[model samples]
Target: MSEHRILKLFFFACLGVFVLHFTMTLLHNTPEKYLTPRMESYSHLWCYPTFHQGWALFAPEPQSKHKRMEMRYYGPSGWSEWYRAEHICMDQHIRYRVTHYSKLCHVTQNTVYHLWMAVDHFDQQDRPAEQFYPQNMGYGIAMVLAENYAHHFLPEMEVHTLQIRLILEDPFELQDPEVIHFPTKTLMDGPE
Candidate 1:
């Protein structure tokens, strides 16, 4: 091959390697894990750290036998930034909570703040099989993280809430503070 052609090929090879490495690193750092009803699905209980954003999350119990999932948060700016997600089971009268939050900021200054997402899911059941206790879905722990954004924004800002949604594969992008909702359900008693 000519000198110019060889140089171009080398450049492309290097670029590909860099991209691969970056992608792998991102997945590794995220620490994704699969969990079932028997085991607690929570990975990192602490604030899910991210750049130019803040987080508060919790892996909660399914309101019913169905709708089991890992709820997560994503966005920029921190405050009473409460965001929630409901994983509606394919076909079952169940609504549960899996609260997961993320945040970012400089480690030096306590310049940002956030709060625990409230009982994001409604407790219409009032009580489940184990009567008495108000069994419902909500933020188990108020996770907080420092969002670093030196590369993007000028003045440091902690994301209070993330514009959450149902994406099979959602990138960690900055979004508005909002909750993602789906049809909720409750089982009914009948003479069957």
Candidate 2:
């Protein structure tokens, strides 16, 4: 074949591969179960960490609610009083530091929420618990908070364990709304 014809053939082959790869990625990401086990395995092995199963962030009917995280640490003396992780926006007089801390709180909340959604998805799919728990963002946030409390809040004390409680409340409820708590435990000794 002529050199021009050979380059044209190579270009077409590349285009075909790209189209096929895109199609496979779409199929892997879709919620519908259509791919065979072998294809699924291939997709998981190759496309993982890039394409994930679909998940909804919120329901069609959004709830008017507020959420916050409170944490307590086990120190040398005993368990310290619960400290609320206040978002910067919640403060009456917001300084630069307050705004920075508030942004951190927002990021932590978002990460935790995403982790919860992932856990829910895995549970619905009946996947093994070991697949997604240890590396989750919720556990990560707990560890970071424990370390911060030990180093900054009480430098003299060493934090052994942490209890992180996520409180959720619906403001629009007519009756008194009991805050929903998702309590999580974390060992401070774990890898940072």
Best candidate, TM-score: 2
Candidate 2 lDDT at 164 equals 61
Give the per-residue lDDT of model 1 (tens digit) for 116-176.
1122223343443223222322211112221122113223433333222222222233443
TM-score: model 1 vs. ground truth: 0.19
Model 2, 70-177: lDDT tens digits are 667775567878766554233522555544556655665675575456445655765454555446566565557545645754667667766666565553334454
**Whole-model lDDT, model 1:** 0.29
Q: What is the C-alpha lDDT of each candidate?
A: 0.29, 0.58
* lDDT assessment of candidate 2: 0.58
For all predicted structures, in order, the TM-scores are 0.19, 0.46
Model 2: residues >4 Å from true position, as ranges? 1-59, 87-99, 118-132, 153-156, 173-192
